[model samples]
Target: MNSEIIITKDFIEIGKLIKKIGLITTGGAIKVFLKNNIVKINNVTPQGRSTKVYPDDIIWINDDVYVVKREK
Candidate 1:
């Protein structure tokens, strides 16, 4: 299943976005994504909390790829 929502400047942090959208647990967000070794940013592993993720950015976690996009 797929869903979409507007990010209205409030969905800044990944952890917050994960919980705010009822996507997953904050702990799972940290363990699976925040680890960098598991998640990929722009096709490469990102190692930072301040990784400004704007619209159209593709985040890959395991076999699932979450495509970021501005609500238009």
Candidate 2:
């Protein structure tokens, strides 16, 4: 399966993306992911409050693939 984010605006924040995409229950979850230190942004565990997520980026937590895109 592939998820697409049609550039509706300039850029989307990772925390916002998680909520917008329904990956987490609340914005607090974004903190949990950060506190636990298990979320990777663009293939590396990110530790920033304002991490910008652009197009064609991967957001993975643990072994589950939260965000991904595949070419058909």
Candidate 3:
């Protein structure tokens, strides 16, 4: 099953997302995680950590996938 997160914003950064998903604990950990893994948004790998994730976007990290859903 895919992991899911609810948001009320237009977008969220990949680093922030890493923490939200509980995949990485500290802010510094994101750097190492990103260096070793790729963040795929909508099935496409993003260029860098600043990649914006919107509602209904599919994000892939490590061996899992997360679905971002907007909350009204």
Which candidate gets the maximum TM-score versus the true structure? 3
| RMSD score of candidate 1 (Å) | 3.7
Tens digits of per-residue lDDT for model 1, 1-72: 334434666335555544555656663555454654456656876555455566666766566567666765
Q: Residue by residue across 1-72, what tens digits does model 2's lDDT show?
A: 335644455567777876776667787778776777567777886656468776667777565555433333
Pick by lDDT: 2 or 3, better one: 3
Each model's TM-score? Answer: 0.58, 0.63, 0.84
After TM-score superposition, the amount by which residue 44's alpha carbon in candidate 1 deviates from its true location, in angstroms, is: 1.9
Candidate RMSDs in Å, in order, are: 3.7, 4.1, 1.4
lDDT of 3: 0.82
lDDT of 3 by residue, 11-57 (tens): 89888888888888887787778878866788887777677889888
On lDDT, the candidate that comes out on top is 3
State how far residue 11 of model 3 sits from its true place (Å). 0.8
lDDT agreement with native, every candidate? 0.57, 0.66, 0.82
Between candidates 2 and 3, the one scoring higher on TM-score is: 3
The superposed Cα distance between candidate 3 and the true structure at residue 59, in angstroms, equals: 0.8
**Clashes per model (N, Cα, C within 3 A):** 0, 0, 0
What is candidate 2's CA lDDT for residue 67?
A: 49
